[model samples]
Target: MDLIACHDCDLLYHQPSIAEGRKLRCPRCGAVLLQHRHDCVERCLMLVLAALILFTVANAYPLLSLDLQGREQDTLLITGVIELYRQNQAGLAVLVLCVSILLPLIKLLSQLYVLLPLYFGWRGWRLPVAMRIVDILHPWAMMEVYMLGILVAIVKLASLASIVPDAALYAFAALIMVMAATDASLEPHDIWERLSKTR
Candidate 1:
């Protein structure tokens, strides 16, 4: 029997061999401890690809357009950061840039670096280390939080100006859902075991 520690209750229990597409719960707290997602790598990779395309659209096109008294203004993801800096909110600009842009990009790139080679059965350099680093950076990828903030801002700005939803806004919304699914589908323990065998 494999010993597993419950993250919620900190109770150690003998982990049972769970089949694919099944979940293992902690006996003491009844908390879901492990989920074996079959074909986790393939599913995660597909979601990541969708996210990447959406991410590009989210950055390339205007997020929202503002029409105020015959004047028009549009903003993309990076444009917001620049606007903040231009308005002398340097700290806020940095925060948005890091959480919304930099960290998420790093997470996606690293996942691709690790997963692509593994999927194709090719040996890649430093894949294990890259995967570890990606895990560390995951928490910092606050795309969902940033999306929530944007929604709130849109609500607040609606009364001030005519807020027009753009293609990027829809793309960003889809990206959030895809990213969430990717997180749910990815089984880190299984990934590590598979990676070790390939070495």
Candidate 2:
């Protein structure tokens, strides 16, 4: 893959080979600029480690504290789901649990599923199915969505009570950042390159 840029203007283009479908260019400048990253697997692994740590913190502690009507209350991530479940919104509660809890775990696990084998240079087994699962799970891991939900709840409840953000909320935010970093750092071309070397 050739990364071409205009000498006269700051335009980038992804000069593709015959096999790479089609060439691409910078839309704004039309200078053939396309974004790409190098050493994606290595960078993604680093981000994954950070995300794992943040995920642990998010799940292990209270997300927020509230004082209302002369009473104190704190809610963990699971607690919110439980509260929803108790309110008879079983489906919504389950969806929350799935998105908040299960999806992150699946994303982490699926990443490991690919990373570990690739790291160890294992090419004996088929990974296409596992890759598909990773693709499906990536969109479902909604740390940012959960963070927005928490923020909205805090804003809506602030008029009625005193609220304090907790460490877990910060951790959740960090997890979102880490996930974004993983996506930005990981290059599909690098992964394919590694696979080609393995073959």
Candidate 3:
């Protein structure tokens, strides 16, 4: 038997075997204690794969093209980071790179590493560590915020030059949505239960 504590009311209860599409709630405060989503692992795995493909496309293509004075220039996702560094804004460059690029990549890869093996009924190597990393990096992956900043910059620069959204911009937008779906579909309690059983 397992035990769970209510986060809102500090009420303790025995964890029950909840069926898929079901939720366990705290009796006193009515706070949600646990939820069992149907086919969460499989759904999350597919979403993660899609997110990875989109990530690749987002990084490879130009996010936007600028045309001014009969000259055109293309900018990839990393282009802004590079420009920031060139402008001697090293701290801002690193912050953007970490929050927008590195953290998201790490979180996706870590989810893949953990979920892929678990889906196949095998325990992934260093499963706990990978899952921990995923939880830790969740808040730090700020792709949507970065996308907002890009949009703001585009609006500000519209009067100076013609700005055309590129393949990477669309891909990045899709990636953000897909990543959010993946997070929503993931059931951490189910994952931990599977991990414990496989050990």
Candidate 4:
């Protein structure tokens, strides 16, 4: 087993298996040691599916609707990103889209692809190292950050009009919940162990 010492604090963590990826984490500072997720792969997979459903609602439905001056306006999360791009903040728009929308989707899909088959006793063991890439991407996906931003925007907009939260907003919040649960539950080593055993 490979061991990694935490850079922030003096603690050591074991690599999930082979020296394939970076150390999964540093237990002391909660930094990335390597890319493996949590060990409860099956549980996390279910959460991923739930998150995907929430993600659909988050993107497809209007996030908020406002009525002011006898007019009503509604905006979806992606619409806000598009508006940002039109305002010449393409980088910021892309960042929002990727972090809030794309990353969550990728995480859900990646987790699903690996977990569903394994639960069904399929060829989960045969999947190559691409799952490692999913692990690598997990840390960067910040749905909470986006959620905070959304809350701030909602608060700011409230004083200006009759702001009514939409289905997507609720869905996004649920998505955040599910994603967090999945992140907490899915562990790479456990999945690998199960997969390896099946082989």
Candidate 5:
């Protein structure tokens, strides 16, 4: 048996060696104390790989096309940031770059670093550090928030112009969902246990 404290209510409980894909809830607050994600590391690794591919596609292709006054304008992920910088919105540009691109990339890479080695029976050089980085960067990965803003923009612009969602937008949208699923399916405790066992 293991002694676990609920992060929400601070209630301590005795936890048994639960099976995979199971969850333990806090009896006092009804918060999830622990969960077993059934092959969480492998699933997270695959999802990370898929998210990376989609991230590439999202950045490579045009997010949307704007047809205004018989002229068409295409915009990629970086294009918006560059344009913002060019227009003297440097602060906003940097913010967008950090939350939308840099943080997500870092989170994905860190997860890969931690998972790939564990998957192949090899220990990562700094697994704990990599895992720590992932935890720190998780809240900063705002691709989904960016996607939501884009959708809101589309709704607002629909009344005035022809806004066509492009391949990159779809890729980004899917990337958001995949990343979310990856985070949900990931069990950090399980990873830590496996890392301890392997070492």
Candidate 6:
């Protein structure tokens, strides 16, 4: 038996073995204390793999191309960060670099590291540390916010230049959706249970 505390009401309850797809709720506040997701590790692994591919594509290709005055320029995802740094906005550049690129990449890779080993029935040293890193970096991954800012900039620049959306733009959009799905399918409680059994 496992003792679980309700995040909402702080009531502690003994967690029972629940059937797959079922949830244990807190008696006082009715907050879900534990949930059993069927094949959560497998599902999350696949989603993380897809997200990795999308992340690669998003960074490799040009996000959009600008055609202004018969001159065309293609902008990669890192262009803005580089430009910001060049303009002496080092702090903002570092912030964007970490939140939009580095943090998300690290989070995805950490998820992969944790899920892949668990899926293969192997125990890795410091697996919990990897999961902890993922949890910490979760809020710092702000690709969606960056994408929204891109959209706003595109809308504003549409009159000044002919903006053509490119492969990276689509890849970035897909990445956001896939990352969201990965987060939803990932059950931390299930992961913790699996980790506890590892040698």
Q: Which ranges in model 6 have alpha carbons more than 4 Å from their true place?
A: none
lDDT of 2 by residue, 17-117 (tens): 43233335555555533334444566677778788888899999988989999899988989988989999999999899988889887887667666666
| CA RMSD of all predictions | 1.7, 6.1, 1.3, 5.7, 1.4, 0.9
Per-candidate TM-scores read 0.92, 0.78, 0.95, 0.77, 0.94, 0.97
lDDT tens digits, residue span 130-153, model 5: 999999998999987788878888
Q: Give lDDT per model, in order.
A: 0.87, 0.75, 0.93, 0.75, 0.90, 0.94
| Per-residue error (Å), model 4, residue 46 | 1.7
Among all candidates shown, the one with the greatest lDDT: 6
Q: Which pairs clash inside model 2?
A: 12-32, 12-33, 13-32, 13-33, 25-32, 26-33
lDDT of 1 by residue, 87-146 (tens): 999999999999999888889888888889878888889889989978899789898888
Question: Candidate 4's residue-wise lDDT over 1-199, tens digit each?
Answer: 8666765786876755634333456656787644543436656767887888888888889988889877999988888789899999999999988887787677677777778877777866435454775777787788788789878987887888888899998998888888877766666556776767666
Give the alpha carbon lDDT tens digit for every residue of 46-156 in model 6.
Answer: 999999999999999999999999999999999999999999999999999999999999999999999989999997879999999999998899999999999999999
Better of 5 and 6 by lDDT: 6
| lDDT by residue for model 3 (1-199), tens | 8889998999988888887788898989998777887588899999999999999999999999999877999999999899999999999999999999999999999999999998898756889899999999999999999999999999999999999999999999999999999988887988887788778
Candidate 2's C-alpha lDDT? 0.75
How far residue 189's Cα lies from its native spot in candidate 3, in Å, is 0.4
